[model samples]
Target: MFLFIGLVLFGADRLLLLLESRGHVNWRRTGRRDLSAEPTARLDSLLEDPDRRPVRRP
Candidate 1:
C-alpha cells in the first residue's frame, strides 16, 4: 500500500546516503593521497629545533 511504498523509498534514500558517506561509487572512482610521511618529518624537525619560532602573519 502507500505506507509500504513510502517506507521503501525512505530506506532506499538512507542506503544511498550511507554508501556515499563511506565513499562508495555507482559510476566513477575517487580518493585522496596520504600525507602522513611529510607531516611526521615536519613535526619532528619543529620539535627538535627549540630556538626556532613560528613566523607571525602581517
Candidate 2:
C-alpha cells in the first residue's frame, strides 16, 4: 500500500516538472532579488573600537 502511494506521489512530481518545462505553469519563479551584491553599510564598524586601528607593517 505504501509503495503504491509513494509511486503515485513521485509520478505526480515528475508530471509537474514536465508541465513546468513546457511553460504551461511556473512552479518556482517568485519575485525575489538577491541584495548581497549591493553595497551595504559597515554594520560591523559599530561594534569595533575606533582607537584599535591595526599598525601598518613596514
- The lDDT of each candidate is 0.69, 0.77
Error at 48, model 2, angstroms: 59
Error of 1 at 37 (Å): 28
Per-residue alpha-carbon lDDT of candidate 1 for residues 1-58, written as tens digits (9 for 90 to 100): 9999999989987787778678784422334546674545566875776457776779
What TM-score would every model get versus the actual structure? 0.42, 0.45
Which stretches of model 2 miss by more than 4 angstroms?
Answer: 28-58
The residue pairs that clash in candidate 2, if any, are none
Per-residue error for 24 in candidate 2, Å, reads 0.9
Runs off by more than 4 Å, candidate 1:
26-58
Show the lowest summed lDDT stretch of 10 residues, model 1: 25-34
- Please state every model's RMSD to the true fold in angstroms: 7.5, 12.1
The local distance difference test score of model 1 is 0.69
Q: Kindly give the stretch of ten consecutive residues in candidate 2 with the minimal lDDT sum.
A: 25-34
- CA lDDT of 28 in candidate 1? 26
